[model samples]
Target: MKKLMLALAVASLSSAAIAQETYTVTDVPVKEKSVETNSFWSNWFISAGVNYNAFYSSQEEGISKNPFNDRGKFGFNVAVGKWFTPGLGIRAKFDGVKGVQVNGGVWSPDNIDFDYWNLHSDVLFNLSNMIFGYNENRVWNFIPYLGAGVIRNCSQNNYMMGANVGILNTFRLNKRLSVNFELSALAAPKSFDGIGYKASGNKIWRGADKVFTASVGLTVNLGKTTGFRKAVDVDALMALNASQLDALNSALAAQQNENARLKEELAKKPKEVIKTDYRKEYVGAPRSIFFNIGSSQIASRKEIVNLQVLADAVKADSNIKLKVTGYADSATGSAAFNQKLSEKRANRVADELVKLGVSRDNLVVEGLGGVATLKPNSYNRRVIVDVVK
Candidate 1:
């Protein structure tokens, strides 16, 4: 029962992870990231779990009897599966069931013990991730499957071909380990149970027999440790690229026009006039370096331009120094949490400035935790840069 509860908790978390897109960088194109190509070993998994199974004979009335009365019928299953894509996969499984207790009602007044070994192949669908969108950090997943296989009934000394449909809930503990809770129903022929349904004392009916099972187990993710490729939002990235290209074109056109205007003005003036030393004043707004929530990486490439500007300013004047302060959103995190997040954000920006030729001694870096906020929670995840002279 404890295993079952743990599985449930993990499954819940996986569902929530699927719905979050926090790492997605808005207003910027996604950088090139590696993805595992489709290959023989790309998306394989292996699992072993303990199962509790109940048998249903056709002779029973009102669907099912007390499942717990025969709850002692425990089983184990081992399976290997692979995903061809994020949505679909196939698995081959072997199950050994024991002491499946059954009561003979009306047809006989005795209890029977059932046991079987089943070898099955199933096609699986990742329903949870499909609807919610795939998240690499997601911890829970829901998979539903349908399968068919041959079952060897050891107690009855017979064999039967059967089909099963079930849902597998996976709670990822980490990249390599996950807990699984699955529930499935198996349908087989009554002959496999050594029970023949009869009409008026003559054997005439052969409807489907039933076996229900619930299992909890751990799965070792094989092949790709992540078991999935990080999904790229192609549409969003393309839109960002188009916007940047358009801005570049507009800037080029404006510069050309400005040069033409300057040439016309110079042509009108005396070319022999004495030239005087002139200094162009550089004026710009302070920059905000944005980061993803819970991330300190220098993610926004656009921010590099801002850092370059500060580097130039500081280089031109040894007296000039820049202050960098980082912050985290308090709406979702604690003070201790925000403090660490803020510190990382500040240091990351400072490191980037240093790499861009600014001296570390000329920069004042501070992690203000959740103190300064420009636009509430989401916008608070940032590092601000101000030049001081």
Candidate 2:
């Protein structure tokens, strides 16, 4: 819970600091990050491609196993799909032209191919998007799917049921254009091929038919809602504001306790008795200016009024030497960065002292880097002004 609060506090402070300024990272401008979301009508696409359809059957167990010269023939496919999220989607596809097979379960090169159409609707999963986060501008994406469809041999007027599975690879060319490569397999009853060899040589035909395919095509995204936009949560920001208020109240309480301690220490000190002929020495209690965590600027210029009083005493005594030291919290920033930040803070306070009529040569400005001498991390982010004897 402490870690969460610290993160939220940093975020809240950053939000307030950059409310009017804009910054960039790498090439893209920075924006608040959130989840990807789209409406039902968004992310819809259509595609068309040519494929090589290879028919598989246990009946042709011993047929020549050369792919380019086998019963696999050229065909075409068209599909329509929609992405529901970065990881999931659905697609309906139509594939067919002609499929090839052997007559009498024997290899004779007699060209016994049949005309058919296969329609399948599959639940698609984008592996790239699911594994890595979604990037609409990403060049390539890998997707796989599974579904059931109807297969009809138009030449024989026969219809059968089929199950389908496949992997799709797409390369994005632009906002609306993509090149697609797909590999798929479908399984159906052997009779759906319209090959009436009835007995597969002598015995009765059995088992299912498999069609393996490899296709290449192009896709067109339908509309403008191609990617997700980050959303700003108003409620979380409001909570951060409340947390910031609590932090300020705590700082105020710390300051009050510090004032009471200073008063107690002063009461114990002996009073100085200077004769009328003696020169008065420039004297004052040590003063400190607080800052917000990780910042070098003074949190409040209210401390400047107190410094002005110290400056007047210094102007009266040329022998008075004052040291202005700055520090950062040990909990944040790198050692080198904190050192530099402290130096900057000390100089900032010294400049203010000079503006109030204190001689620059009498003021020694130094930075002690990071320290934890004070309670609460915020108290460590401060600059102290003390008389140097």
Q: 107-213 in candidate 2: lDDT tens per residue?
A: 46654788989998999998887787777788999999899989998888999889999999999999889999999998888777765333345443346667889
Best model per TM-score: 1
Query: What is the lDDT for 25 in model 1?
Result: 30
lDDT of each: 0.72, 0.76
Off by over 4 Å in 1: 1-37, 60-64, 101-109, 197-206, 225-239, 253-389
Q: How far is candidate 2 from the true structure (C-alpha RMSD, Å)?
A: 15.4
Q: Clashing pairs in model 2?
A: none
lDDT score for residue 99 of model 2: 79
Top lDDT model: 2
Cα error, candidate 1, residue 381 (Å): 26
TM-score of 1: 0.53
Candidate 2, residue 352: lDDT = 94
- Residue range 10-64, candidate 1, lDDT tens digits: 4444333332322233443332342334777777889999988877765555333
